[model samples]
Target: MSHLFWLDLQNLKRIQHLFPKPRGVARSDDRKVLSGISHVIRNGLRWRDAPAEYGPHKTLYNRFVRWSRLGVFARIFRELAQPGPDGKTIMIDSTHLKAHRTAASLSKGGLKPRAIGRTKGGLNSKLNTVCDGRGRPLTFFLSAGQMSDAKGALALLGSLPPAKILLGDKGYDADWFREALAERGIAACIPAHRGRRDPASHDPCMYRKRHRVENLFARLKDWRRIATRYDRCGELFLSAICIAATVIFWL
Candidate 1:
């Protein structure tokens, strides 16, 4: 195994407990695929030069695609999301993704109003995330980047415990949104809306950690397939994100 994946793959192979390597022989070189995956994640290879030793190229790619669709990665992400002992305090944020031109062509272009907008950047999407105080992602959502940050924030926070406190920016300011969180017994720690004479204060001490979501975005882009939007189907793009999130959660 290459130095990149020796330990990480040993554990993953153990957890996975199955999945044949290439050629249907007793191939134990699962580590090579892992290292190749690291190569793709770190260096953004085109997937053709994934290294010959990682078994047949098709085999390794198929394995990654299978694991991605099976929700195996999503399970890993969920396990990574550990609420504090108090089970409270979450931060939510979103990131933009500029779709490749090929992706724009894949759009069915329908009554989905949010899908019809465009910028000089071509089609865009948002990767919304909610994380615990420790900066682990608990929930994530995908929408057209043209979508309002707050429009998606509510759905991401909807699954959180009602008693927990949630923090975000002024974009989340809305009487209905606040009321929705409040109704769930959640404290909307976001600042007041713009132009308000006075607004209640939240704990800057905690809000400072909101950068976790940003950092998560940074880490996710490390995956080549995700760093640039390539998938044409929205579901496949979202699946790629879920898989990437799973990879980070485990690490």
Candidate 2:
């Protein structure tokens, strides 16, 4: 039911340009990296527990890190992003993903606040993600569970310019958010937060269409990896989300 997974390999050919180099010394091509990374996400397995076909767990993890540090995943989203000058609408939302018990970044105190906090879900991490009108992710952010959905909107939506419209819910109704996008000429359609004195700026019809973001979460959960945070580092967890989004985008 997800457009990304439902897309065929032939349709996914466009992705080859982005993942030209496969991870691992023994891996021969990008296909291996794609498969190796995809396998981990779909099954929610540990990196060190990657299957034999993936060459080495460290290799896959290293490659993921190298690519992430270099902004490869962000580039993929930028290049493959749908809501262009001639495309459909855009939507944004965040979802909480519970970290694995033994996940590295988890700790009750010290510097692990990035991974541990209290949300409605108790101890968890929140994935702030952007998607097109049809539920395809365009960008994402990984913050502590206590982080608000509105916290990362500026970073996520500010990156892309030249769009007809953007969508969101009551969580993103900030005056600066409107001014931020207005400066770039992007139509900020986020709904008003509670107790907002200013009138609403979003269209109810288009706002209803924001359900695509929820559907995107549903599809992403199909990949157990994203459903749970097994990675200790936020960077690694985000990389997995990026790769998973890529797989879905290309699907």
- Note each model's CA RMSD in angstroms: 4.1, 4.5
Candidate 1 lDDT over residue span 1-251, tens digit each: 34343337545754464343346566545566655655554455656767666666676666567665666555655665567685677777887877766667654655433332365666777878887776667777778777788778766765774447888887887778778888888887887876877666777777777777678888888776676676566655675676566566655
Query: Model 2: per-residue lDDT, tens digit, 1-251?
Result: 22112334674587657764644654544555556767877887777888776677777777777877677876776677666454446777888888776663434444534454566766678888877667777777778888776677866865554566778887888887777777776687877777767766678887888888998888888889888777766666777787777777645
Model 1 CA deviation exceeding 4 Å by range? 1-10, 17-35, 84-87, 108-117, 161-163, 197-200
Give the TM-score comparing model 2 with the true structure, all chains together.
Answer: 0.78
Best by lDDT: 2
Model 2: pairs clashing at backbone N, Cα or C within 3 Å? 4-248, 4-251, 7-251, 105-232
Worst 10 residues of 2 by lDDT: 1-10
- Per-residue error (Å), model 2, residue 47: 4.0
